[model samples]
Structure formats: C-alpha cells, structure tokens
Target: MSFLKKIQQPKFLPNFLKVAIPFFVLVTIFSLAINSWSDIFAGDFAKVAEANFNNGKWKAFFGYKIVFSAIYGLYITNKNMK
Candidate 1:
C-alpha cells in the first residue's frame, strides 16, 4: 500500500525512534517517580506494587504510555516527512 511505502522510507524509522524513545523513557520515569513518591518517602517500596495492582494504575499507566508514544512517534515522523 502507498501508506506502507511511505513509512518504509529510509528516514522514517530513525526519525520516529529519535523522538519516541527518549520521550517514552523520560515520561515513563517521571510517571513512575510520581506514582511511587509516597512509597519512596516512606521507604516502603514493596507497597508500591500492591497499591498499583489494587488500584489498576499499572494498566492505565502502561496503556497511556504505549498509546501516547505511538501517536507522538507517528506525528513526528509525519511532520519530518513533510
């Protein structure tokens, strides 16, 4: 398909990764820091997992990260193409 061909261009993957990887890492770290702040302060790191599991925060965090990263990557890639 034409869309596939466009994305197959040599620069496409590098351009997407250039924006996506760092963004994902930074955002993920920031999110983890925020979410674990209380546990960190209390020095009870084990509770972090229990809280996240009970509240389903982990699912939301992972979902948002994956979705946003892909969207941002595609947006940047398309912008670079133009």
Candidate 2:
C-alpha cells in the first residue's frame, strides 16, 4: 500500500526522534528519580557542573554525542551513496 511504502522511506527526523525523544524522557525521569533538582536549587549541582566544565567534562559529555552524530551521519551517507 502507499501508506506502507511511505512509512518505509528513510526519514532522518523520525529516526532521530525515535532515539532523541526517548533519551530526553529517560534523562528527565532519571533526574526526577534522583531528586537532583534539589541540588540544583541548593547550588551543589551547579558547583559540580562548573567544576566539570572547568575540567573539560563538558567536552567529554557533549563530544560523545557529536561523535555519535557524525558516525551515524556517515553511516546514513554511505547507505544513501550505495
């Protein structure tokens, strides 16, 4: 059917959303579960985050996502090329 064919087409936003939305949900759940918002308001989490930022943990944290996106993009590009 046309609907099935349409659904089968490779769409980046849907694929990324499948991963990203769930990731965001999980992070939110984890944050709430750990009650880390209290630490945020108390200034403890900010201090830790600041220390991590100064020490380059922010790079490590965000860099992995960048690397992953690059790799995934490459994979998609190669697949499309083929």
Candidate 3:
C-alpha cells in the first residue's frame, strides 16, 4: 500500500525512533512516579505492587504507553517529513 511504502522510506524509521524512544522512557518514568507517589510517601512499597497487580493496572498502563508512544511517534514523523 502507498501508506506502507511511504513509512518504509529510509528516513522514517530513524526519525520515528528518535522521538519515540525517549518519549516512551520519559512517559514510563513519569507515570510510575505519579502512580507511586502516595505509596512512596506513606512508605508502603508492597501496596504499590499489590494495587497494580490486583487492579490490573499494569495492563492498562502498558496499553496506554504503547498507544500513546505510537501516536506521538507517527505525528512527529509526519510533521518532520512535511
């Protein structure tokens, strides 16, 4: 498809990776900090893991991170190409 071919161009991958990797890492760390802030302050590390596992928050976090990173990467790549 034209869309696939366009994305497969030599410049696309590097540009996408340049923005996406750091964005993904920063987002992951920021989300963890925010999510664990209360637990950290209260000195309850066990509760953080318990809540994440029991509420299936890990799955939701992974899904959000992937979706957001992909969307942001594509947006930046498109902008740069244009």
Instruction: Give TM-scores for every candidate, taking all chains together and pairing residue i with residue i.
Output: 0.71, 0.37, 0.73
List model 2 lDDT by residue over 1-82, tens digit each: 3434443657744655555555545654464435455666677866656644557766765565556655555445344431
Give the clashing residue pairs of candidate 3, or none. Answer: none
Candidate 1 accuracy as TM-score:
0.71
Model 1: pairs clashing at backbone N, Cα or C within 3 Å? none
CA deviation > 4 Å runs, candidate 1: 1-5, 53-57
Model 3 ranges off by over 4 Å:
1-5, 41-44, 53-55
lDDT of each: 0.80, 0.54, 0.82
Q: Tens digits of per-residue lDDT for model 1 on 5-81?
A: 76989988888989888888888878878878879788887887776645777788778998899889988787668
Higher-lDDT candidate among 1 and 2?
Answer: 1
Q: Where is the poorest 10-residue window by lDDT in model 3?
A: 1-10
- Global lDDT of model 3: 0.82
The number of clashing residue pairs in each candidate reads 0, 0, 0
Off by over 4 Å in 2: 1-8, 21-25, 28-38, 65-82
lDDT tens readout by residue for model 3, 1-82: 3446759789888999999888999998788778888997898979877766457778887788988998999887877773
